[model samples]
Target: MAGKGVFEEIIDGDVYKYYADGEWKKSASGKSVPIINPTTRKTQYKVQACTQEEVNKVMEAAKAAQKSWARTPLWKRAELLHKAAAILKDHRASIAECLVKEIAKPAKDAVTEVVRSGDLVSYTAEEGVRILGEGKFLVSDSFPGNERTKYCLSSKIPLGVVLAIPPFNYPVNLAVSKIAPALIAGNSLVLKPPTQGAVSALHMIYCFHLAGFPKGLISCVTGKGSEIGDFLTMHPGVNCISFTGGDTGIAISKKAGMIPLQMELGGKDACIVLEDADLDLTAANIVKGGFSYSGQRCTAVKVVLVMESVADALVDKVKAKVAKLTVGSPEEDCDITPVVTESSANFIEGLVMDAKEKGATFCQEYRREGNLIWPLLLDHVRPDMRIAWEEPFGPVLPVMRINSVEEGIHHCNASNFGLQGCVFTRDINKALMISDAMETGTVQINSAPARGPDHFPFQGLKDSGIGSQGITNSINMMTKIKSTVINLPSPSYTMG
Candidate 1:
């Protein structure tokens, strides 16, 4: 692995302290957590784990900051966000390098993610000024001749504090997706970056500060979520939460009382192939969607549901494509890289072995080295197998045969997760029918189920998530509607 070269360059002497009240400081309890570089499997940095006292201080600062940030003219806030986007663009290379070192994201994918985050920042900035609530004219006919009218107005107002918890997979993009919207919508933020990917997040926040955002308007508190997540969520000062992770979302909803939550949780997405589908194209997309970023994306296609008529042929095509994928350092040009941790590799390997024990045959050789598990394609994977239902979060794909499109849809909907799914066919009617019938948040007819543009609605269903998250939708999610009505008196009228 190319050691942390540019990663060390960016964070040279950068403070890893807990940021609050527009300043960085150590934890009141003097506690810290070691940040590991997944690629090198070495401890590269230490971030302070905020204690309860620091959590309170950060929330208090957020509450205070929200009052003024919310009062700032919407256009001014939008301008600041645009400035932040430009600053991020200037540091794009460094941020991408940090992602590769911090979370083991591939170099190309990391750079793309940085660009995506910048787009999100710019999108939210433009949306904040354009998507304002409009006024409505109301007429009352309570007494026929005695008429009265009222002018009503509605607009989105900031919710005081938003606690944004972003996952490790997309350290820069996901965190910025949340932070940019919250700030543009005039809400103060307390971002809790994934401990494993804090360095990239710190670099991102510093850009926001340099962009001239108001002090205390945004804070990034580094700590174990189990410790400070609940404390901050349950705090009286915090008004909303935007979390992107696993089952922790349910707990956050329960513990946070009645605050609004925008969460995008785990996904067990599926890629369904029909008999008439293009096998080579499907294979190519499956390999791209499944093995990219080592399958760490929430929308990664973990299972391939193929009709029995084309199962064998499709598996062969996929096997051929898998052979060409390179498994090595993320800094190199490779199809796969080391996953976030050794445990993820073990879990994925266990699932593959379990399928093998249960009569599933591997279409390709299973190669493992340290945290990198080369792409594995399991054919004849039964629905009862864990690999068929679980989110592997690694470079593995389970292929299951189905008799009909209905059977494939049934299998796809049977899981507790319903984040996203894809179907392949040339017939538009069948595509629409399958898309309408699939029990997921988003359905792709010919494309992989994955995150798209920053302006599109991105979310999940079932246990996958609570609310939508994109530029416009997220700004709406971070704000509350305030309605006002003004009564107007008319000249006296004779009864009809």
Candidate 2:
């Protein structure tokens, strides 16, 4: 088991070093970036900010380590991954504590995130071992002119090195989601965790380190994306990329030519409520989905489209639920905590103001305490309002009333993002109809939009993402199928 030494070092405010060549090394640049606590607006700690030259060194090291790491048997890789998962589970409390301070995640949710990450790692390992390479016999006799003499065998092989960039909203879970699959699939990894949540991610990476992965197989580089983002993505050493962020993903896509890319951009997930829907179920899901983690998730319910006939009743129920949500610092385990940064709060506030000016009605007085913006629920939001289309990524939910189910589906499809959406209704046929009609990747029948308790085939249709992501899907993306064809001897016609 990994000791808590590294976690203690980070919590004690020691300047943390980036992990490269399988060891923690001080940045050659001698510069560092502060990790801010959103709740207190204080520097929780600082991590080394590597220079471009340092990034180059880490990439070269990873590239050099790839062949040996890839040559390791799948069973051996799975064993290490299982060990890392156990270590992560053992350190859940310490990592969750760091998560609470670094990103303002509620204590309970932070703990859950760590545990879930462990499960993800474990699942990836188990799945990796079970994945079998395919083989098939190809016969030439089907063409009627040629004899059968060919055999084809296909096997999964790793893409050299995967560059994983995780968003601040889910640093541990998303980072591990990328790391576990890439490693289990026989590829080396370079993790560029979000600057805001780097410390927590570093702690997770330390578990892999303690699991005895080969030198340089896994590396962590911490720096401003502006400084190293382009260089890292465009670097020749990176064979593939698995990224989770917003506009940064767009920028990376343009620069990451030829390299296989798996990205999860932000989304404006919508929840549609039909007249026949149960108001209690709809409202409860809305509050839980929209307000949890202060609505920092990419799948958070950004907009609600409800039938105008039932909108009033649904709004009343939602408002009552929102009012009961406790608001305070994450240390207090409140339902609403400060967002990741003040700029995020500013961006969210701007969207709220735009909706208000366009005739949206607020259920509560607008409040802002630094990064902590008390949860706000808005009703009567029109299509013209920026909040209807924009992703606030904060503790605000907007309701837009519509005349029919078609209108709700149209509103969801018109958005540039098609990550996920949901429709609430009692009619099973109606739910399935809307589910098929919605342009988003996944649609919920009567529940608020969510990622999962199970790793289903999660994806986005358009600007939401570039590819699918789940335990199995990610492993497939990280590896390529290689086929070997053999020319067999043909039987003599005269012998028979």
Best by lDDT: 2
Top candidate (TM-score): 2
- State the TM-score for model 1: 0.94
The sequence of per-residue lDDT tens digits that candidate 1 reaches over residues 35-97 is 777777788677777788888888888888889988898889988998988888777887787
In model 2, residue pairs whose N, Cα or C atoms come closer than 3 Å (at least 3 residues apart or on different chains), thus clashing, are none
lDDT of 2 by residue, 1-496 (tens): 1125555433323677789998788887878899898999988878888899998888888888988988898889999999999999989988888899899999999899999999999999998888733334455556776766665677889999899999998899999989998998889999999999898898999889889999999999998778997888999999999998998788889888898989889899989898899999999999988999999998999999999999999999999999999999998999999999989999999999898787889999999999989999998899899999999999999999999999999999999999999888999999999999999989988887877753688888789989999988999999998878777687323255
Which pairs of residues collide in candidate 1?
A: none
Q: Clash number for every model?
A: 0, 0
- Model 1 gets an lDDT of 0.83
Models 1 onward score TM values of 0.94, 0.96
Which runs in model 2 stand beyond 4 Å of their true positions? 1-13, 132-146, 491-496
- Per-residue error (Å), model 1, residue 251: 1.5
TM-score of the candidate numbered 2? 0.96
